[model samples]
Target: MTTVPTSAPQRATAPPSEGGHRRRRSRRTRERPNWVAGLTSVVWLAIVIVPIYWIVITSFKTQSNYYAENPFAPPGEPTIANYRLVIESDFPQYFLNSVIATIGAVIPAVLVSFMAAYAIVRGRRSRLLRWTNSLFLMGLAIPLQATVIPIYLIIIQLGLYDTLLALILPSIAFAIPLSVLVLSNFIRDVPKELFDSMRIDGATERGMLWRLAFPLTRPAVVTVTVYNALQIWNGFLLPLILTQSPDKRTLPLALWSFQGQYSINVPAVLASVVLTTLPILILYVVGRRQLLSGLTVGFGK
Candidate 1:
């Protein structure tokens, strides 16, 4: 009877699977939809796209149709008469002026900014360089609008007033700070070993600049050029104050004049806008990738 009193065997139970439970929870959280952010993005996208749609559609419509039809509707019968009118109304002259000012200012500004940035990064130990960099940064802190009166005085004194040079000079000043700031940081991102190796191989400072640094940071250079070109192209106040002659007027000035003259012809004004926007849009499309890379140089890299 005592020998028959054996205890029953117990079944081995599995331990709690905490990791799998946690993973399931994480999956659920990851898969969860963000309604608020999605909704906000859609709202903002519409806000931007709606105006662009209206402008493009309106540009193709006749003035009578523009006023008579729904503002956002596609043209019933699109016409190029508005474009022809804008082109014939001295658009090419203003466009050429913009091209000249943009090219003149951007080239020098980029070259100077590139060298200045290289100096600032490569000569960090030099007190003079430090001071110069500080001065350039200080320039950025001062708003361009605030300096309009002083810039006007300087342009007038230099006899650059009523000339494309008037636009070019001030644009160079404004463009340099941001270009240098972006470029110096981009240069700083270059591997120190590569620089040292280049130096060891008998490369001089100038050699290293053009051969090594320039190639690596060329994206950034393109970025600044496109960005500055865009800014100078669209600049209004500078052209308004700096030049008085219609012959020296840039695209922004041309657009303003379009508004004044075609106040009643809404489609014609929009047509002029579309034509004026084409170059900038093309420039942007060409350099968009390089521009993005250049502008975002040191961030999260």
Candidate 2:
């Protein structure tokens, strides 16, 4: 009875060889350098940030110091003199002109494009819709340069040259095609069931668009609006060709005033450049989140 006690055999463990293999594999992965990808990213950032740094630094320097001193060096005495001069000059008028033109151009462009896009998406099977969409797409290919001469002549005939309306009208006309394209693509993705449900509830086309589709398509709308704002806000060529008076000038033209016929005031010119770019920078910063979200929502779905 005392000799009956016994134990089962234990399972054998793997040798240290398997453990060493796993450790070596992990160590190899850890040792692999991602230097090339990291270096490329750093270089790209430097390329973008350097110019912005130079502009901001140059804006603080005196006119003589800008050219005489090393461009890379910081100013000895950073001054607001240039900004004061710019503000006291006709810059405010030019800023107002720019605001007027940009707003006027963007609002109508967005509204008209939204309607066109909705129609294109809803009426995709119709021949007339196909023709209309093709025409809108063609508008994108036509260069503004080709139309400038005719546009200028027409502006003169309408006696709208040197006025904000002239700038707004032309910009709206050109911006619509791209806006339509962006919005139409987003509209096409909206669930047809939503539209059917609205129809069953006795909703009209306008009601469905306003109550349902418009709300759903907000991201695409935001992206298009921001895009148009950037275009209209920074436009130089159209304003240059259309308007002449200093008072009628937009920011780009106003900035040109700092460059004289004989010698360019480099510092002042750079200052103006900084001033002109600030609005756009601010706009991007403020709307960037919404813009990014919109783009993601529109494309990711």
Candidate 3:
């Protein structure tokens, strides 16, 4: 007997509906420009930019024009006299002092912090290391103001007062806590497989650290270096309290010297401020991408 030909069963399909289209339209509406956010950004930008612009314009104006002209007005006849005066003064010496202090502090702080972070991350199983990490975290809560008195007394006792070393030493101490915190977090994000692979290849921990950790953590290194450099460069209070001589004055204190008892030279003072800030601005511009990357993203295998 001939059997009837068998046929495959047809699968059922839902009828096309407007639900997905409607959902997409709703999402599109929600994704439209947030006017509130845009307006807030514009307002904040104006507030920041206006003052910087004012400082620039004010620095170029002559003293007579500075007062004669409106505070916000552009300089009708700009002169370099303010900058010339700043240069003629001991600005170069103060600049050198700032440079010395910044370099002295940042190098030691970064080196110590890097080693500390490496130890903390690699030796997390050790209770001593764990406690040390806690100690660093506690450091973040201690304000500089609270410790200034003790620091002053210590500096005096050690004969470090009125010296650039005084400024450099304290800056390193303060910079280490934040540097360690940042670097340890970055180190922890490194993949465990890489460490294991290195170990299998007969690489010692120190070798792995030099070959692996340093290369991998470059962005974090740049970030902390620029950050600590900026802090030490612009530092005013430490130099003010710890130093005693005009010859030892940093840029911040030199700016203070521009103020006279009777009248303040606004243009000259702003010029010095601009000059002092330029180096920091240049440093940030150079390392900005790496700094931003280290802060925002983590490394992986």
Local accuracy by lDDT, each model: 0.92, 0.88, 0.90
lDDT string, candidate 3, 187-265, tens digits? 8888989999999999999998889998899899999999899888888889999999999999888877776521468
What TM value does model 1 have?
A: 0.91
Ranking by lDDT: 1, 3, 2
Query: What value does the lDDT take at residue 135 in candidate 3?
Result: 94
lDDT tens readout by residue for model 1, 1-301: 3667768888888886999899999999989999999999999999999999999999999988987899988899999999999999999999999999999999999999999999999865888998999989998899988999999999878988899988898999999999899899889989989889999999999999999999999988998889899898899999999999899999999999999999999889989899889999999898898888766766755
Best-fitting candidate, scored by lDDT: 1
Off by over 4 Å in 3: 1-26, 298-301
**Candidate 1 residue runs with Cα over 4 Å from true position:** 1-24, 295-300
TM-score of 3: 0.90
TM-score per model over all chains: 0.91, 0.85, 0.90
Candidate 1 vs candidate 2: which has greater lDDT? 1
Q: Which stretches of candidate 2 lie over 4 Å from their true place?
A: 1-33, 261-264, 297-301
Descending-TM-score candidate ranking? 1, 3, 2
RMSD (CA, Å), each prediction: 3.3, 4.2, 3.7
TM-score for candidate 2: 0.85
Report backbone clashes per prediction.
0, 0, 0
Candidate 2, 1-301: lDDT as tens digits: 3787678878898677978999999999889988998999999999999999998998899988887899989998898787877788777899999999999999999999999999999864898999999999999999998999999999999999888899999999999999999999888889999999999999999998889889888878888999999988888899999998888889877776666621455676777778888898898898887789777874554
Tell me how candidate 1 scores on lDDT. Answer: 0.92
